[model samples]
Target: MNDAPLLEVRHLTRHFDDVAAVEDVSFQIKPGEIWGFIGPNGAGKTTTMRICATLDLPTKGDVLVNGISVLANPDNARGKIGFMPDALGTYADTTIEEYLDFFARACGLRGDMLAKRIQSVAEFTELGHLMGRMMDSLSKGMSQRLCLAKTLLHDPQLLILDEPASGLDPRARVDFRELIRALANQGKAVLISSHILSELSETCDGVIVIEKGRLVREGKVESLASNVSKNELLNLRCLAKTSDVEIALAEHPGVLKVRESEGSFVIEFDGDEKDIADLLKTLVNKNLSPVEFHWHRIDLEELFLSFTEGTLS
Candidate 1:
């Protein structure tokens, strides 16, 4: 793959009347890379992505898909991008096969090329078995798969997936993540948005965080993890029962704060590797009998909340 960016958002701004939904946001996605577009609701993520997908016009700046200007030449840019939106338009009385065929023709595909693309995406999304089923009768998971299959019909180099993993079950989410990785391996660049930070953490190479219509941060996942959060997030669970885990953790001078979860305690520790090991031993000696003790350098949720004030524009 080329080192150049397949998708570039340069100083993009979008407004409706007097309110700016997006303000001076910019990011780049290189071929075979996955960049997560993340922000809370009303954070202009959808607006920014819409501009890149040629679904909305930018009030300022430009977006380039495969170096083609979407602002000036959307018709040509459309050929280079595949956009999977949050909702698939209701095609009443349309079968899965019929819906895909409609889009295949709309994409200017015909004859053997059209048939090949339809079958290819169907197989890729595992929609081949449900090809005869009505679109309206499909479950949320299947609908998401269908949305992706529609997006892939054009074989675009750049893919914009808006909340692609939202509402999906665990298995469906896992399959979607693998699908995204496979697409990137085939030399496609993806800009995906979702509220599920954990899923994005596992799949995205980097992220673009937008808040209140402004660009806040954009960098590699690990780079952001190290720079944005300095403290360690530890999850501690006991095999017997939830003990005075907080009191046991307090024995370690490295622990900063503690919060309770389902059956585990989330500890905020400003400790080194040795401090962590010492904390484990300290808990064991205290009769906490920990069954699971895990620690991670980053929490995308905390990183998100720390940067944004939950303000809506």
Candidate 2:
């Protein structure tokens, strides 16, 4: 197995005349990892993915797939990457199997090898039953699956999927998530974009958030949530009224603010685990018995909101 990163983007920037679609973005995806590419409308996610797929040129910077630069060797880069655009166009007259077969042939697969690859992807994507279905007659979810199967026909190491689950139903989304996980387990690197932050939080190993074409943040989901610079929010349910507990917490240097909730107090603390322990000790020392203490970790949605001001291109 290759130890190098499956995909690497360094200072990627794309300009359309006077408009900058993407600017100075950089990130990497390792083998067996699924990275979520997230941003609002017109945030340059598509442009970046296009450049990574070798379908578009970058005004500045470069993309490397398996250590091969896309700008320098686009054909080689394309050979290593399979790109599925957000809006997949299908041949209205062709069947699902025929569509995949066309792409397989285009990718230079033939004979038993081509048939084997098609059947393998069809089975993996659960599209075997839909093989004879017309592309125009398939549901959106099934169409998406067919597109994915086509992308996988080439057996690329890195898969770049743009808004893959955009129109999927609940069950379809669940199945798609499982498929992505299975791909990662098979040592394929997946870079996917989606507007569904909650689902991304559950499915992605990490995420790269960009806004106005600039990279805002990139890290593992849990790491990014925990590393947010903002004060940590904690909830405390005390055996007694939170009056004394509030006062005690307010006096502690680690506690920034304490607000009363229905039956507990919400504390904004500026400290780490040791500081939290010290604060709890101080509360207990003040004769305040906390029946429940829970630290609220910042979720991906909150972190995204904190970075981007809900701005769209």
Candidate 2 structure quality by residue, lDDT tens digits, 16-65:
99989999999999999999998989999999999999889999999999
Off by over 4 Å in 2: 236-254, 257-266, 271-293, 309-313
The whole-model C-alpha lDDT of candidate 1 against the native structure comes to 0.88
For model 1, what is the error of residue 191's alpha carbon versus the real structure, in angstroms, after optimal superposition?
0.8
Q: Name the 10 consecutive residues with the lowest summed lDDT in model 1.
A: 304-313
lDDT of model 1 at position 172: 93
Error of 1 at 79 (Å): 0.2
My TM-score estimates for the predictions, one after another, are 0.84, 0.84
Using lDDT as the measure, the top candidate is: 1
Q: How far is candidate 1 from the true structure (C-alpha RMSD, Å)?
A: 3.9
